[model samples]
Structure formats: C-alpha cells, structure tokens
Target chain A: MIELIQHLINGFSMGSIYALIALGYTMVFGILQLINFAHGDVYMVGAFTGFYAIHFFKLAEHPSWLSLALTLVVAMIGSGCLGWCIERLAYRPLRKSPRINVLITAVGVSLFLEFAGQLFFGADPKFFPQVLSFEGDWSFNELKINPLQVLIFVVSIFLMLALDWMIYRTRLGRAMRATSFNLEYASLMGIPTDQVISLTFVLGSTLAGAAGVLVGLTYPKIDPLMGVLPGLKAFVAAVLGGIGNVRGAVLGALILGLSEEFLVGYGAPTFRDALAFGLLIMILLFKPTGLLGLKRAEKV
Target chain B: MTPSTKIKLNYQSSILWGIALTLVWISQSAWIGLMNPYYLSIIIYAGINIILAVSLNLVNGFTGQFSMGHAGFMSVGGYFSAYITTHYFAQSLDSLSQIQQALIFLGSLLAGGCAAALVGYCVGLPSLRLKGDYLAIVTLGFGEIIRVVVLNLDSVGGARGLPNIPGLCSFGWVYTWVLICTFVIWRIIRSSYGREFLAVREDEIAAEAMGVNTTQVKVKAFVIGAFFAGVAGGLFAHTLRYLNPQTFDFNRSVEIIIMVVLGGMGSITGSILAAIFLTTLRELLRPLQEWTQIDFRMVIYSLLLILMMLLRPQGLMGTREITSFFRNRRGDPR
Candidate 1:
C-alpha cells in the first residue's frame, strides 16, 4: 500500500506538469479550433530561456528564492513574447485559410523551432542548473517523498490556481470566453477578438514556460526536443478531457500520468512510452468527443 | 477532328509514352551500370522519396485524410522484408543465379507491401472515422507506437537495428518500382474509384449523400497508399542493406509530408518533381554545412514550408498536372 502511494505521488508530480501544458493546448484549441503543433517548442523555448537566465544571472551562486523567482519571470516573459510572435507571424496570415493549412503551418513552425534549436544549442543535452538545492525528504513506513517532488507539486498547484483565478475572474477572461463562444458575435459586441486571441497565447505560453522551468528543476536535464514527449502526452490529455475544458485537462492529465506510472511499475518498462499513446488510440476509438466533450450537432 | 485522325493521335501519343518510358528505363540502368557509387546512392534515395511522397499524396491530398504515421508503415515494410530475406534466403541468395536472386527479391518486396497494407487497413478502420485534426493526432500516435514497439522487439535486432541484409534493390529495381507505383496510382486516380476518393476529400457528408461509401473509399486509399509506402521501405532496406526502426521516425514522415505539401497536394507530377528537387537540394546543401558553421538546410526547408503555407498553400503545381502546363502553353484554355 505504501509503495502504491509512493508511485501515485510520483505520478501526480509528473501529471501536474502535463496538466500545466495541457491547459495551454486546451485554451488555444478553444479559441482558434486549431491545434498549435509548435506549442511543444514553446515549452522547449521556455526551458532554454530559463536555462540561459540562470547561467547569465549567476543565480546558482546566490541560491536564493528571489533569484529563482527572477529566473522564472524572465522565462515566462520570454516564452510569452515568443508565443505572441508565433501567432502574429506564422498563424495570423492563415486565419482565413483552411484548417489543414493552418495545421501544416503549425507543424512547419514546430520543425523550424526544433531544427533552429539544434543548430543554435547543438544536439547535446544540457544539465539544468539547480537554483535551489533541497536535499530534505519525508518518509513514513516505507513511503518516502523528496523535497524536489514537493516543490514541483507546490509550484504547479499555485500556478494553476492563479491561472484559474485569471481565467474566471479577470475582465480579459470574460473577453476570452466571449471570443471563444463566438468570434464574430464577440467582435460585433466590441470585444477585441484579435487581442483576445493574442492574450490567450500569452497566458497559455506563460504557463507552459513555468512548467518547463519546473520540469528542468526536477529532472535537471534539458534538451531542445525534451518537450516533444510531454507535449504529445499533454495533447492526449487535453483530448481525453474534452479538449477545451480546463478542469477536464487537469483530470485527464492526472489519469494519463498515473496510468503511465503504473504501467511502468507493473508492465515491461520498455513499453512505457507506448502505453500512453496506446491509451490515446483506445480512448479516441471509443470516445471521439473525449471524456468531457459534448457533441455539437453538425450543420449539413 | 475526324475519327481516323483521332485514332492516329491516340497511336502517336501512346508511341510517345512508350518511347519516354523506354528511355527512362534505359537511362536508369546505364546510370546504375556506370555511375559512381556516391551519385548512384543519391538517385536511389530520390526514387524512394518519390514513391513515399506520391503514395502519401494519395491519402493526404486525394482523400483529404491527414496521416502523419506513414513512416510507421515504412518501418513495418522494411523490418518485414529484411526478416524474410535474411531468414529464408541468407545463404541461398549468395550462390544463386541472378534471375533467382531477382525472383526472391520481388517476393520479399510483395510480402512486405502486403503486411504493411494489412496493418494500414486495421489502423484505418477505427481511426478513419474521425476527421481533420483528430485523425492527424491518431495517426501520429499510431506512428509513435509502431516505433516504440519496434524498439522493444529483439529478434529483428531491436534498438540495435538489422545490418547486412542482402543488397537486392538496385537502380533498376527502384526505377522499375517507381514506374509501377506511378502507373498504378495514376490509373486509380483517373478511374471511377479516384473520383470517389476525390469526393471524400471535397466533402464527406456530401459524398455520402451522393451514395459514395466514404468509409470503403478511404480504407481503399489508405491500404493502397500503405502498400506503396511499404514497397518503398523494402527498396530502401535492400538498397541500404540495413534496417533501423529509428530510420522511420516522425522526422521521416514529416520529410515525406513536406514533399507532398510542397509539390502541391493531390498532384502526382508535383510530388515526383518535389521529391527529386528536395532530395537533390538536400544533397547540394551538404557542402554548405562544411563551409558555414551550421547546417541551415532544414531551417531553410522549414521556413519554405511556413512561407509556402502563408503565401501559396496549394504548392508548386497546385492541382494541375505537368501535362496541363504544356497544354496551356500550346494555347489550350486553363
């Protein structure tokens, strides 16, 4: 029972990261109804930004909460700008184009970022600098928890709560909801639809950036392509949670992470990655609308 | 025109086609027979890419189904073909006559294609029900799953990969198969079945309303596309004399998609031209890496794709054929 608890806790930590990323996917999909294939690269950019920030600011020498906060702020802002630019540049022109055309452009952006990253950073993986060294652990009756896991859980929850408040309570949030509900109607009502879309990208990219830094801190290894797997899994999570539902994204991510953990624990570890994708296929087959999705009547 | 003149024109056109095909076959054979190994390798790769791009175009362009897991089918074909060739004829092929070796090669390629087609059908059945982005995600997942599964299986060398498979794919084999693939696909698209596939692409609900079995048409396209992809994979495997699951990763699928998209989706001639151009461009850019400090070819390619989508998403030829370009030049109304 204790071992199971331990595994569950581990899964929850990973799930939190996925949930954070899935929120970005869900939000963009909600407003645009287009899958942003380059969202994963944004996560990667966040990690790299945080990485460079730490190195440039010499935060490791100070090893304080303020420095960590500073690094995260820089990463978030940097990633947010990138997200905005991606929207304004690659996607805006294709607004009136076909969905598949936009999707392909998104993929092109993704490939551009991945290869550019490889070219700029080299293909070798970088070791993320640990700004805060938390060596402490909590253990009870064969159940143990590391400080890193606690940090990850605490940070992700706090950010998610802030996001929830921003989405539900802010004026921008209302505008976003209106825009997603109906862009033309929202625009007719004097809401700045384009700005709302841009804001959505900024908010979503900010969260993904935070997750990226948190993942680097916990895992301590970063690469240009590190976001690809997590990005894909989070996409699956978003789909599982009915895509546009924020709360459903969290629930779905938790399930995905837990299932992956259990599969790794019990099944052949070699099949670990495959298990998540296999689950995606199975869920898609059974519930095309996803777990929390409501089917809309098609107009013939 | 008179009936007699029409008959004469038909004979003339067929003769021209025959002459072109013969010249192509003879030239390919001569190149393989005489060219340096380095240049020969490039031509072979171009042929494989042509097959992949054209086959994928059948699904993505003609049927309007977004399939990003084409490399999965390729890997299946590669691994299966290599397995049969290595296990059954490893020793026998060494001392066999040239004709016997050619026969065994053909058999293996066919087996590989059949296996891939079967897998494609199974995957298509459930996944093809979805449209657009959902279908893309499912296919992407399937591709990744295939890669991971292949990585774990040890008998076919697992992560280490299969090496020293017999070199059965030559310039002749590649050219011949490329010819066959193009001919078959061209025929299918020009036939009534091709119209059904196009109907599905235009609008599925409308197609269904018109009594087209959209599901059956999609499955057929998926299967046929996979078969050609598998044959390409088999050719690739034999030409390289090695098989690695890693070779058919998402990047490979994307590369093929790039060709299809850049060539003008749904245009076979465009795919063929784009494949050859992109393959040659990649080779030509090899020296740029040495001269500069970075390899920017992929960067250029990605930018080109984005720019293409932003400016002209229809691609190089759009839906028009090469023959149409010439006909237009000859004063035919476009």
Candidate 2:
C-alpha cells in the first residue's frame, strides 16, 4: 500500500511538470493549429538555462528565497527569449506553405537544435546543485513525501492558478483567448495577432522553463537528451487531453504519468512505451479528437 | 495533365532495350563467367531500393500522406522473411540445385511482399480517418512499436536481430524480382487506377465527389508501398547476411522518406535516383567522418534539409521523372 502511494506521488510529481509543458503545446496548437515539435527542445533549453542560472547565482551558498526567486526569473526569461527567437527564425516563413511542409520544417528545426545543443554542450549528464529540497518523515500509512516533491506540487498548482487568472482575467490573456477563439475576429477587434502568437510562445515557454527548473531540482540529473522523452510525453499528453484544450492536457498528463507508474509496477518495464503507444492508437482510433477536444463544425 | 504532353518513352524500343539489358546483366554476371559478389550486392541493393522508393512514392508523393514509418514495414518484412527462411524454407533447400535455390528465392520474395502488404493495410486503415500531422505521428508511433517489439523478441535475436537469413538470394534472383517489381509498378501507375491515386492528391473532396473511392485508392497505394518496403527488407537481410532491430528504426524510416522526398514525391525514376544517390552519399560520409573528426553527419544532414526546404521545396525533380529533365527539355522554349 505504501509503495503504491509512493508511486502515485512520484507519478503526480512527474505528471505535474508534464502538464506544464503540455499546456504550452496545447496553447500553440489552439492558436496556430500546428504542432510545434520544437516545444520539447525549448523545455530542454529552459532546464539548461535554470541549471546555468542556479549555478551562477550560487543559491547553494545564499540558501534563501530571494536567491531562488532571482534564479528563476533569469532562467524563465532566457527560455522565453530562446523560444521567441526560434519562432521568429524557423517557423515564421513556413506559415504560407502547406502544413506538411511546415511540419517537415518543424522536424528539421528540432534536429538542428538537438544536434547544435549536443555539439556545444557535450553528451555527459550534469548534476544540478540542490536548492530547497529536503527529506521528510513518513506520514499517513508510511508514505514519505520529500519536500522537493511537495514543493513541485505546490509550485505547479500555484503557477497553474496564476495562468488561469491571466487567461481568464487579464487584457493580454483576453487577447490571447480571442485570438485562439477566432483570429479574424480578434484582429478586427484590434488585437495584435502576431504579438498574441509571440506572447503565447513566450508564456508557454516560460511555464515550461519553470517546470524544467522544478524537475531539475527533483531529479537533478540533467543532460542535452533529457528533453526528448519528456517532450514526447508532453506531446502525447497534449493529444490525450485534446490538442487545443489546456485543462484537458493537464488531466491527460496526470493520467499518463500515473498510468505509466502503474504499468512499471505491474508490467514489464520494456512494455512501458508499447503501452503508451497502444493507448495513443486506441484513443486516436476511437475518439480521434481526444478526451476534452471538441471538433469544429464547418459551415458551408 | 494534358494528353498532348504525354511521356515520350518509346515502349517498343524500350522493350528491346530491356531484353538487351537483361542479357547483359545475366551474361556479364553469369557463373561460368561468374558474377562478382561485390557487384551482386550493389545490384541487389539497387533493385531493393527501387522497389521501396517506388512504392513509398505512392503514399507520400501521390496520396500526400507523410508517413515516416516505411522502415517499420521494412522490418516487418525482415522478421517475416527470417521466420519463413529459418522455420520452413531452409530445411527444404538441402537438395540445392541452382533451380531449387531459385524457387526458394522466389518464394521468400513473394512472402516478404505479402508480409509487408498485410502490415501496410493495417497501417493504412488509420489514414482513412487521420489527416496530415496526425497520420505522421501515428506512423512514427508504429515505427517505434516495431523497433521495441523486435528488441524484445528472444527468438529473432531479441535486441540483436536474427542472423544468417539463409543467403540463397543472388544477382540473378534480385534482378528477376526487381524486374517483376518494376514492371508491376510501371503497369499500375500508367493504368486508370493510378489516375485515381493522383486525383486524391490533386483534391480529396473533389475526387470523393467525383464517385472515386478514396478509401480503396489509399488502401491500394499503401499495400503496394508496403510490398516494396518488404522486398527491400528481404533484399537487405539476404545481402547483408544479417538482420538487426536497429537496422529498421525511426532513422532508417526517415532515410527512406528523405530519398522519396528528395527525388520527387511521385516520380518513380526520381525515387530510384534518390535511392542510389543517398546510398552512395552515406557511404561517402563515412570517409568524411574519419577525416573531419567532427562526426555529426546528422548536423550536416539537418542543414541540408533546411537548405532544401528553403531552396527547392518541391524536391530535386518535383513530380517529373529524371528523364524529363533531359529528354523533355529538347525543343523547349528556353
């Protein structure tokens, strides 16, 4: 029972970060209707940024909330800038081409970033310096929850709530929502569509960066290739939740995470990927749109 | 598009030319005048790739389905051929006259094509519903699944691939199968059925509205493509005298797609050209790897792809055959 609970917590911890990244994928798809394959690589960039930021800030020495806050700001901003540049350079031109061409371009950009990252940064995994993580005592049926895991959960929930507030209440968020709802309507209503798209990328990348930082703090073993699986999982999460729906993606991520852990417990570890793909195929075959996805009815 | 602009390959002369070429292939490669093993392998590789790219061109170029899982189907062919050779055909070949060996070779090629065709049908069923990126994603998933399954199977060398695929295939065998493949594909493409496949690419809704069965056309293209991928896989297994799971992974699929796309989506000759060029280019990159000490061929490859997209989005020859680039240019306005 304790192991099950522990696995559940671990699953939630990983699931929370996946939700953050998946939200970004869902949002971009909502507005553009294009799958940004590079989104996962941006997550990697964010994690690396955080690694550099934490290393430079010496939060290991300062050991305070202020240092932590400062490190996060720098990392998130760096990731946001990286995301912005990638969008401007690679994707902007392909907007006029066929969607498949754009997809191929996305793949090319992804490969370019991954190889470039591999080239500049060597293949060895790096240890992220610990900041606020602390081991906690077992409570409630002997399930121990580390402070880092708890912190991740808390931070993720807080960020999600803040995002909700921004999207539902703020002017920029309103413009974003309007653009996603109907780009033509938003543009005619005086919302800057290009700016909205850029902002969406920025905001999505920033949240993903935040998730990266938290994930690094929890796992700490960072590498250039770390984003590939997580990125793939997040894309799956986005699909499971229904491509354009944010909350659905979050729910999808959590479900995938939990289910994967359960699979690990009861099934062959090698079958983990097979199970995930099976679910994907079945979901796509039956639902097509996803759990929370709505099909847009075309008008003649 | 217009009847007046019909392709001008002289069929009667080409038939005579084909016979002359076959006589040259057989005589130049015969045992009393023995075919060199080195040349045999290259000839076999070319034949296999011709089968693969021509078939893949149907789905990717003609039908406009961006499937990157051609290697998955290829691996399926490999696995099936391995099973048949080891369990069924290997024992029966003890009486091994040249004619008996030839019959077994024929059986394996057909078996490989059948295996690939079946898998292709299953994969194509998804395409009837999904469009564009979704289909690509599914194909990628399918490729990964094939790799993982091959890795886990203990009988077929588990993570290591099944080795010693009973090397009965040879220069004559490969060319014969290649002839069959080429003739079948050529006839299929020129027939009215090929017109339906092209119609799906020109406009799906219009094609569907015109009483054309889009589903059947898609299924047909997919089946043919799978058959070639299978034949290629079989040729690869027999030629290399080994088979491994890694040989038909995601990257392998991407390599095949790059050939079809780089050559010209629907152009059979373009795919053939691409297959040869890519095969040689990769071999050439090996020397560069040792010399440059910067062994990131993928980096160079990625850059090449980006440049291709930027410069020639329609690929090297587009939908036109390589022959068109030269022969059709005569008496042109330019």
Candidate 3:
C-alpha cells in the first residue's frame, strides 16, 4: 500500500511536468491545427536558458526562492520569444499552404532546433545546478517524498491554475478561444487572429519552459536531445486528453503519468517508452476523439 | 496511333529494355568489381534509398496517406533477413555455388519483404480508418513501438545490435530491386487501380462516394510500400553487414520522406533523382564535417527541407513525370 502511494506521488509529479508540456501542444494545436514539432525543442531551449541563467546569476552560490523564481521567469520569457519567432518565421508564411507542407516545415524547424542546439550547446549532458537543495526526504511511515517533487507538483499546479484563469477570465483568452473556434469568423470580429495565434504560441511555450526547468530540477541531467522522448510522450498525453481542450490535456497528462509510473514501478522498465505509444494507439483506436474531445461530423 | 497499339508498342519496347538492362546487370560483376569500392558502396546505398523513397511515395504521394513508419518496416525486413542468413546459412555460405548463394539471398530477401508486408497489413488495417494527422501519429506510434520492442529483444542482440551479417547484397542486386520497385509503383500509378489511389488522395469522401473502396486501396498501397521498404532494408542489412535499431529510427524515416517530398511526391523519377542527390550530398558532407569538426549535414538538410517547403512546396517534379516533358516536346501534351 505504501509502495503504491509512493508510486502515485512520483506519478503525480512527473505527470505535472507532462501537463505543462501538453498544455503547449494542446493550445498550439487548438489555434493553428498544426503540431508545433519544435515546441519540444523549445522546451529544451528553456532548460538551457534556465541553466545559463543559473550560472549567470550565480544561483547555486546563493540558493533561494528568489533565484529559482528568476531562473523560471528568464526561461519562460526566452522560450516564449522563441515560440513567437518560430510562428512568425517558419509557420506564418505556410499558413495558406497545405497542412502537409506546414507539417513538414514544422519538422524541419524541429530538426533545425535539435541539431543546432547540439552545435550551440554541445552534445554532452550537463548536470543542472542544485539551486534549492532539500537534502532529505519527508518520510511518513514507509512512504517517503522528496521536497523537490513537492515543489514540482506545487509549481506545476500553480501554473496550470494560472493558465486556466488566463484562458477563462482574460480578454486575450476570450480572443484566443474565439480564434480557435473559427479563424475567419474571429478575424471578421476584429480579433487579430494572427496576434492571437502568436500569443497562443507564447503562452504554450512559456508553460513548456517552466516544465523544462522543473524537470531539470527533478532529474538534474539536461541534454540537447532530452526533449525528444518527453516531448513525444507529452504529445501523446495531449492527444489522450482530447487535443485542443485545456482541461482534457491536463487530465490526459495525469493519466499518462500515473500509468507510466505504475508501468515502470511494476512492469518491465524497458517497455516504458513503448507503453506510451501503445496506450496512444489504443486510445486512438477506441476513442478517436479522445476522452474529452467532442466528435465532429465530417462535412463534405 | 490508336491507344491500344500505342500501349502495346510501349509494352514491347519496355520488355526489350528490361532484357537489355538484365544483360547489363549480369555483366555488372565484371565492371563493378573493378570500380573503387568506396564509390560502389555509395552507388549501392543510393539505389537502396531510391527503393525506399519510391515505395514511400506510393503511399504518401499517390495515395496521400502520411505514413511516417517506413523505417519500422525496413528494420523488420533487415533484422528478419539478417537473422536468416546468419543463423541458417552461416556455415555453408562459402561452400554453396554462386547461383545457389544468390538464390538463398533472394529467398531471404523475399521472406523479409513478406514479413514487413504482413506487419504493414496489420498496422494499416485499423489505423487506416483515421485520417491525416491522426493517421500520421498512429503510424509514428507503431513505428516507435516496433523500435522499442526490437531494442528489448535479446535474441536480436538487444541494444547492442545484430552484427556480422553476410554481405550478400551488391550493386546489381540493389539497382535491380530499385528498377523493379520503381517500375512496379509506376505501373500502379498509371493503371486504372492507380487512379483510385489518386482519387482517394484528392478527397477520401468523394472517392468513397464514387464507390472506390478507399480503405482497401489505402491498405494495398501501404502493403505494397512496406514490401518495397522491406526489400530495401534487406539490401541495407546485407550491404552494411549490420542491423542496429538506431539505424531505422524516426530520423531515417524523415530522410526517406524528405526524398519523396523534395522530389515531388507521386513522381517516381523525382524520387529516384532526389534519393541519389540526397545520398550523394550526405556522403559529400563527410569531408566537410571533417574540415569543420562540426556535424553540419543534418543542419543543412533540415534547412533545405524548410526552405523547400517554404519556396517550393510542390517539390521538383510536382506530380508530373519526366516523360511528360518529352511528350510535350513531341507536341503531345499529357
């Protein structure tokens, strides 16, 4: 029972990070209907930004909540700018082209980011600086929890709640929702769909950046290629949660995280990656619209 | 000239050309034996890539099914055929006559292709119901799952990779398969059934409404494409003399897709040209990498892909054949 609870906690923390990434995927997909393949690399960029910020700010020498907050803010802003740039440069011109063309371009951008990242950052893995070290686990009987994990959970939840509030309560969020619903109609209503799309990318990438930093804090090893698997798994989470639906993305991410944790904890560890894809295939097969996705009839 | 007579004359000439090509291929051992081994290997690799790109174009280009899992099928063929040769014919390979060895290699290649086709059929059956990006994601998932499974299989050397496979594939075998794959796909594209594939690509609902059995046509395209991909994989394994799971990853699939797209999707000759160009370009990048001490090949390739999509989304050939140009010159506009 204690082991199960322990796994659950681990899953929740991991799932939160996935939620952050999935939110980006879901939001971008909602607005543009294009899978921002580079979004994963943006997350990597965010992690690297955080890494540089830590070093530049001497955060490790002066560990505090302020330093951590500063690092997160820098990463988020950097990634958000990157997301905006990618939208303007790579995707905007292809908006009138075929979806396949846009998709291929997105892939190109993704490859460019990954390889360029390797060129710029070097291929070797770097140990993320421990900015806030809580050198022990909180033990409750046989169950134990790391303070970093708690921090990850708390920060992710707080971000998600902020996202929810922004989407539901703000005028920009209303514009974003309207644009996603119908681009032409939204533009007709003077919504500045282009700006809305740009904002969507920015918002999504900011969350992914936050997730990247949180993941670095938890895992401590950051590399250029680190985002590939997690990015894919998070995309799967987005799909599972019913892509384009914010709440669905979060729900789907938590489910994926929980299932993956259980699989790794109990099942063969080698099959962990496969399990995500397998779950994706199964979900796609049984529920094409996803758990919370609405079914839309095809119009000729 | 009457259409029937034109087709007959074309068919007869094609047969003669096939015979001539066969004779040239038969005599290739004499000439290819003397060529620089380095250049020969690149040519062979280019041929294998042509097979991959052309086969992929059949599904992605003509049929408009975005399958990002061609590498998975190729890996299946590679591992399966490599296992057969290593386990079964390792001892008696040298003792066998030349013809007998060739026959065994051919058999194994066929077996590998059949295995991949079967896998493709299984994957395509349920997944084909989905459209566009959904289908792409499912296929990508299946591909990743296959790679993960292959990585876990200890019998196939696990993550260490299966090594020491016989180098039975040659330039002749590769070109022959390339020609065969290209010819077969071309025929399919030109045939009445091929029209169904185009119809589905143009609009699935319209094709279905026309009673075009869209699902069956898609499954067929997938199976055929997988078969050729398998053949290419077998050739790759034999020529490379190794089978690594990493070799057939998503990047490899993207490389093949790039060939199809850059050449113009649905254009067989374009695929062939793009495959050769890209393969040669990659080889050329080796020296540049040595000079710069940076792996700029993928960076350049990605930039090319992006620029191509941005500037020329229709690709080089844009669904038209090289023959169309010649025909137009002859005052017969296709």
Candidate 4:
C-alpha cells in the first residue's frame, strides 16, 4: 500500500511536468493546427536557459527561493522569446502552404535546435544546481514526501491555474480562441491574428520553460537531448487528451505519467517506451479524435 | 497511331528495354569490378538510398499519406535479414557454390522484405484512417516503438547492436534492386491503378466519392513502400555489416523523407536524381567536420529544408519527370 502511494506521488509529480509541456503543445496546435515538432526542443532550450541562468547569476552559491524564482523567470522569458521567434521565422511564411510542408519545416527546425544545442552546450550531460533543496522529507507514518516533489507539484499547479485564468478570463485569451476558431473571421473582427499566434507560442513556451526548470529541480540532471523522450510522451498526452483541449491534455498527461511510473515500478523497465508509444498507436487507431475531442461532421 | 499499333510498339519497346537493362547491368558490373572500393561503396549507398526514396515517394508523394516510419520498416527488414543470415545460413557460405550463395542471399532479402511488409500492413490498417499530421504522428510513434523494441531485444545484441553478419550485399545486388524498385514503382504509377493513387493524393474524399477505395489504396501504397524499404534495409545491413537500433531512428526516417521531398515527391526520376545529389553532398561534406565542433552537415541540411519549404516547396522536379523536360525542349508543353 505504501509502495503504491509512493508511486502515485512520483507519478503525480512527473505527470504535472508532462501536463505543463502538454499545455504548450495543445495551445500551439489549437491556434496553428500545426504540430510544432520543435516544441519539445523548446523545452530543452528552456532547460538549458535555466542551467545557464543559475551559473551566470551565481545562484548556486546562495541557493534560495528568490534565486530559484529569478532563474525560472529568466528561463521562461528566454524560452518565450525563442518560441515567438521560431513562429515568426520558420512557421509564419509557410502559413499559406500545405500542412505537410509546415510539418517538415517544424521537423527541420527541431533537428536544427537539437543539433545546435548539442554544438553549443556540448553533448555531455550537466548536473542541474540544487536550488530548491531541503534538509529532510516530510514523512507521515510509513509515507514520505520530498520537499522538491511538493515544490514541483505546487509550481506546476500554479502555472496551470494561471494558464486557465488567462485563457478563460483575459482579453488575449478571447483573441486566441477566436483566432483558433476562424483565422479569417477573427482577423476581420480586428483581432491581430499574427500577434495572437505569436502570443500563443510565447505563452505555451513559457509554460514549457517552467516545466523544464521544474524537471531539472526534481531530476537535477540536464542534457541536450533530455527533452526528446519527455517531449514525445507529452505529445502523446496531448493527443490522448485531445489535441486542442487544455484540460484534456492535463488529464491525459496524468494518466500517462501514472502508467509510466507503474510500468517501470512493476513491469520491465525496458518496455516502458514501448508501452507509452503503443498507447499512442492504439489511441490513433481507435479514437482518432482523442478522448476529449469533439467530432465534427465533414462538411461538403 | 492506332491502338493496335501502339500496343505492338509498346511490346517491342519493353523487349528492347529488357535487353538494354541486361546490357547495362553487365557493363556496370564489369566497370565496378575495376573500380576503387571508396567510390564503389558510395555508389552502393546511393543505390540503396534510391530504392528507399522512390518507395517512400509512392506513399508520401503519390498516395498522399504522410508516413514518418519508413526507417522503422527498413530496420525491421535489416534486423530480420541479418538475423536470418547469421543464425540460419552463416555456416553454409564457405562451403556453398556461387549459385547457392546467390540463392541464399535472394531468399534472405525476400524474407526481410516480407517481414517488413507484414508489419507495414498491420500498421497501415489503423494508421491509414488518420489524415495528414495525425497520421505522421502515429507513424512516428510506430517508428519509435520499433526502435525501443529492437533496443530491448537481447537476442539481437540489444542496444550494443548486432554485428558480424555475412557481407552479402554487392553493387550488383544493390543496383539490381534499385532498378527493380524503380521499375515496379514506375509501372504501378503509370497504370490505371496508379491513377487511383494520384486521385487519392489530390483529394481523398473526392477520390472516395469517385468509387475509389481510399483505404485500400493507402494500404497498397504503404505495403509496397514498406517492402522496398525492407529490401533497402537488407541491402544496408549486409553492406554495412552492422545493425543498431539507433541507426533506424526518426532521424533516418527524416533523411529518407528529405530525399523524397527534395527529389520531387511524385516524380520517380526526381527521387533518383535527388538521392544521388544528396548522398553525394553528404559524402562531400564528411571532411568538413574537423573545422566545426558540431555536425554542420545536418545543421545545413535542416536549414536547407526550411529554406526549401519557404522558397521552392515543390522540390527540384516538382511533379514533372525527366521525360517532361525533354518533351518541353521539343516544344511539347505538358
């Protein structure tokens, strides 16, 4: 029972990170209807940014809540700017082209970023600075909870809630939704669809950036290719939740995280990726629209 | 020309083509027999790539399904063929006659292709339903899953990779398969059934409304593409004499896709040309790695892809074949 509970806690923390990344994927997909293959690399970029920010600012020397928050903010802003630039430079011109063309471009951009990251950061893994460490775990009877896990859970939930409020209550969110619904109609209504699209990228990437830092905090190791597997799993989560549905992305991510944790905990660890990817194939086969996706009749 | 006369001419031309191909094969073999190992290796690689690119064009270009899992099929073929040769036929190679060795190679290659085709058929059944980007993701998932499975299989040396397979692939085999793949794809595309594939590519719903079974066409394209990919994989395994799960990852699939896209998606001749050009370019760029800290080749390749999409998205040949160029030169606008 304790083991199960511990696995649940681990799953929840991991799932929250996935949910954060999935939110970005779902949001960008909602607006552009283009699967940003580079979104995962953006997560890697964010993590890299955080890693640099900590060292540049010498936050590790005096690791505190303030330094950690500062580092995260810098990373988020850096990633947000990168997201906007990628959209403008790589994706904007191909807006009128075929989806496959845009998709290929996305892939190219992803490869470029990954390789570029490897070039710049070196191919080796780095230890993420322990910025959010504590003395001991909070234990209740036989159950234990690490402070880092709590911090990850708390930070991710806060970001998600902030995203929800922004989407539901803000004017920018309204523009984003309108643009996603009908680009032409939204533009005709004087909504700057281009800016809205950029904003969507920025917002999504910021969340992913935060997730990157959080992941680094929990795992404490970062590398150039760290985002590939998690990014893919998050993509599966986004699809499982329904491509454009925010809440569905979160739900799907939690489920994926739980299943992954359980599989590794109980099942053979080698088959973990197979299980996750197999679920993607199964979902695509059975419910092309995804769990929360609304089926629209094909209009003649 | 009268239909009867035209049919007779086509039969004569096909016979002449057969003789021409045989002559070309003999001459090329003799030529390769005297060449240095380096250039021969490049040519062989290019030939295998030609097979891969052309086969992929059948699916992504003509059939209009975005399959990002071509490398997975290729890996399946490679691993399967390598396993079979090493486990079942490794001992017989030294004692066997030339004819027997040739037969074993043929059987293993066929076995490899058939295995890949079976997997392709199963993958296609569920995947062909999804359109555009969704299908791309599913295929990507399948490719990654294959890699992960192959990585975990201890019998195939696991992540360390399988090595010491018999070096069965020769330039002769590669070129022959390349010709066969190209001829088969070309024949299929020019046939009436090929028109159905083009129709599906143009618009799936319209094609379906026009009494074409879109699903069936998709499956057909996928299976044929996969079969050739497997053949290419078998060729790759035997020639390289090493097989790793990582070798057939998504990057490899993207490389194949790049060849197809760069060559001109629906143009067989374009695929051939692009495969040659890109493979040559990669080889030429191999020496530039010392000047840079990173793989500038891929960096340049990715940038070129983005620039190409922005500039000339239809690729080098677009939909026009080499024959079309000749026709245009003769004042026949098509």
Best by TM-score: 3
Error of 3 at A217 (Å): 0.9
Candidate 1 Cα misplacement greater than 4 A, ranges: A296-300, B1-21, B28-31, B290-294, B330-334
Model 1 per-residue lDDT tens digits across residues A1-300: 887888888899999999989999989998899888888889999999999999999998888888889988999999999999999999988899999999999989988988899888776899999898666677776778977777778888898888888778888887888888788998999999999999899988998998899899889898888888888899999888888877778888989988888888877888887877887788788887778777741100
Better of 1 and 4 by DockQ: 4
What residue pairs clash in candidate 3, if any at all? Answer: none
Candidate 2 C-alpha error for residue A19, in Å: 1.4
Tell me the TM-score of each prediction against the true structure.
Answer: 0.95, 0.90, 0.97, 0.96
Candidate 4 docking class:
medium
DockQ of each: 0.73, 0.59, 0.76, 0.78
Residue B319 displacement (Å), model 1: 0.6
Q: Alpha carbon lDDT of residue B130, candidate 2? A: 82
- How would the docking of model 3 be graded? medium
Whole-model lDDT values for every prediction = 0.87, 0.77, 0.89, 0.88
Q: Total clashing residue pairs per candidate?
A: 0, 1, 0, 0
User: Local error of candidate 4 at A211, Å?
Assistant: 1.1
Tens digit of per-residue lDDT, candidate 2, span B1-334:
3344444443643585489558746664666135566555665677677667777888889888888789998988878776777667777667678777766766776798798899889888888888888888888787778888888988888877787678876665556666666666766766677788889888889999998998888888888888878877877777777888888876677677777777877787788888788766666687787885544766766666666776677887788765556654685421
Give the best candidate by lDDT.
3
Model 2 agreement with the true structure over A1-300: per-residue lDDT tens digits: 889888899889888998988888888888888778778878887888888887776776766667667766777898899878867777777767888777777777667767777777666788988766344544665667776877788888888888878887799888888888888998999999988888898888898888888888888887777776687778888888888887788899999888888888877878777666666777889998888887861100
> Model 4: per-residue lDDT, tens digit, A124-145?
8889887765878999999998
Residue B1 deviation, candidate 4, in Å?
11
Q: What would the per-residue lDDT of candidate 3 be over residues A169-269, giving only the tens digit for each residue?
A: 89988898888888899899999999889989999999999998999998999998888888888999998988888988899999999999999999888
- Per-chain TM-score of candidate 3, chain B: 0.96
